[model samples]
Target: MTDRPLPNLDHWIADLAPALGLGDVDVPLRPLLDLTRDVAHGVARPAGPITTYLVGLAVAQGMSVDDAHSVVTRLVEERLE
Candidate 1:
């Protein structure tokens, strides 16, 4: 790949969550996992519902996987918006 700047790509991956941070793994997976947890936390509210799904939505802010899923489930069960 050519050394070039992209639209929404950042090099912080190697800075914050490097492969070594994950463990003695052959693949660079820490950055990926860290990013995931990041999205899961960054958008998390103490409570809420109907948050984004697709990993492609990796850019949206608000509601984590756990919190968002919980609120959504509750909304479905309790029949609340």
Candidate 2:
């Protein structure tokens, strides 16, 4: 892949979701992205996606997305202390 700039993430998701049969999926973008940044910075860059996957699993298991995101962010933030 070239280093071309990516499209807006919300746009990408909007296009991709229905294509994957997740047309009704609603993502809380800002909070989850914030969690990604916090995990990447406080832990390591590679941990970001892994942390996000765990959050996704929690959401899939019936936890609220916001709660899952907040739980990871708070854990990482407290770790930085």
Candidate 3:
């Protein structure tokens, strides 16, 4: 790998989203990041990506992002209990 620094999140997303056919979608970065952090800490490290993928699937299936996040957040909270 080159020694170039990685792009920041906004720049990275701007470059990547269109390539992934999500050019018009407004990605809510903070909440998703928070959710993944919670999942990684409260559940398992690997579950972070898996949970985010599930949330993405839910959004594609017509569930609101907030609702999907709420659901997963609850699950993580419960799991930590």
Candidate 4:
């Protein structure tokens, strides 16, 4: 995946994040992507809108490229709750 600086990231995150939960978590793009990838792997599921948000969070967090992949992979099995 190509990494590009998110221009409307904050707005996108705010819109994507569900109300009455997490309270607008300002996750960096790196963590977000990592979380999504991990979530996918954890559930053996494919990428989706949720995963996109995770990627955004990861990039926003300033996570390293490789770390983003690893951390997000961890989320694959996690229950999003």
Q: Give the top-scoring candidate (lDDT).
A: 3
Clash number for every model? Answer: 4, 0, 0, 31
Which 10 consecutive positions of candidate 2 have the poorest summed lDDT? 1-10
Candidate 4 overall lDDT versus native = 0.60
Tens-place lDDT digits, model 1, residues 1-81: 233554234444444345537333232233334434444455444221223334224323553455544544444445432
For all candidates in order, the CA lDDT equals 0.39, 0.80, 0.87, 0.60
**TM-score, one value per model:** 0.26, 0.78, 0.86, 0.33
Report the C-alpha displacement of residue 20, candidate 2, in angstroms: 2.0
Window of ten residues with lowest summed lDDT in model 4: 72-81
The positional error of residue 18 in candidate 2, measured at the CA in angstroms, is: 1.4
lDDT of 2 by residue, 3-48 (tens): 3444597688888889988886777676677778778989999998
Q: Model 3, range 1-81, lDDT digits (tens) per residue?
A: 233444597788888989998886688887888888889999999999999999999999999999999999899888878
Worst 10 residues of 3 by lDDT: 1-10
* Candidate 1 local lDDT, residue 40: 44
2-75 per-residue lDDT for model 4 (tens digits): 48777697677787675546566755575555455556665645665566656557766896656756565545
**Residue 73, candidate 1: how far off, in angstroms?**
0.5
Off by over 4 Å in 1: 1-59
